[model samples]
Target: GAGVSQSPSNKVTEKGKDVELRCDPISGHTALYWYRQSLGQGLEFLIYFQGNSAPDKSGLPSDRFSAERTGGSVSTLTIQRTQQEDSAVYLCASSFLTASGNEQFFGPGTRLTVL
Candidate 1:
């Protein structure tokens, strides 16, 4: 079966440009997540979606960052106004469910560079 997939493996944009990253989760998985990894930094949880429940946007850095899962399968992360601080590798993951301890398969991620 196909695992998580992301588009535009690498992206370079000027400091105020908007960028949209896409993710396609594994078939039938009910859980989806977005994470960001910056240079010389660790992975940071961004947002998550599970089934029909409301998404958890607690981890979103700011209001400029947002995500949505369509048909419970594919997801997209949009950055309203890109900044140098927003430059990082945005990773997406999915799982069967979101329990206390569930396995999450990750996507390769899209590296966004802000110039």
Candidate 2:
């Protein structure tokens, strides 16, 4: 029904802390994605989910980052042992199918500030 939504909008934590970010995609849309963008940087793909297909986790930056999608709708990304380098706007996006040629709607993102 609604467009994509993310929580907290902003976050601050010391290095090595764990954090979880949430995403809610639009109804009837079978495709979802997560991306990260540093200030003045391009979008960094994190993950994608579509129907029953195995998620594409290749974009995850490190072992500290992980995510999951349930029922083809909601998704969550957990970053373990956060780092100051992880500071960035973690954006979430969704589309009608696996990205590539498909346009994605993006969320405002959870801006994580790792100090």
Candidate 3:
């Protein structure tokens, strides 16, 4: 079985430009998550999607950041008007939603650099 995967492992973009980061989760996994890790910082939760439900987007930093999951499989994080502060490693994870807890499987992040 395939694990979570992210595309464009490294992205270098100019400030004010827009960037789209993609993630593919494991098959049949009911839950997916997006996170960002800035320099010297812990992983920051950006969004979460479960099945066909509306996503939990409370963790998104600003209006410039948005995400979408299609057919409960692939997800895309779009950063509009990129900023220097947005430079970070964007990580994706997937898991089964269980009552007790769900262990997350992570992907090699997409390193974003806004110059």
The clash numbers for all candidates, in the given order, read 0, 0, 0
For each candidate, give its TM-score against the true structure: 0.94, 0.91, 0.94
Candidates in order have lDDT scores of: 0.90, 0.87, 0.90
Model 1 residue 30 CA deviation in Å: 0.4
Taking the tens digit of each residue's C-alpha lDDT, what string does model 2 give over 38-100? Answer: 876677888888863546889999989988888988888999999988999999888888858
lDDT of 1 by residue, 50-102 (tens): 96454678999998888887788888899988999999999999999988599
Q: Using TM-score, rank the candidates from best to worst.
A: 1, 3, 2
Assess candidate 1 and give its TM-score to the true structure: 0.94
Off by over 4 Å in 1: none
Model 3 scores a TM of 0.94
- Minimum summed lDDT over a 10-residue window in model 3 is located at 93-102
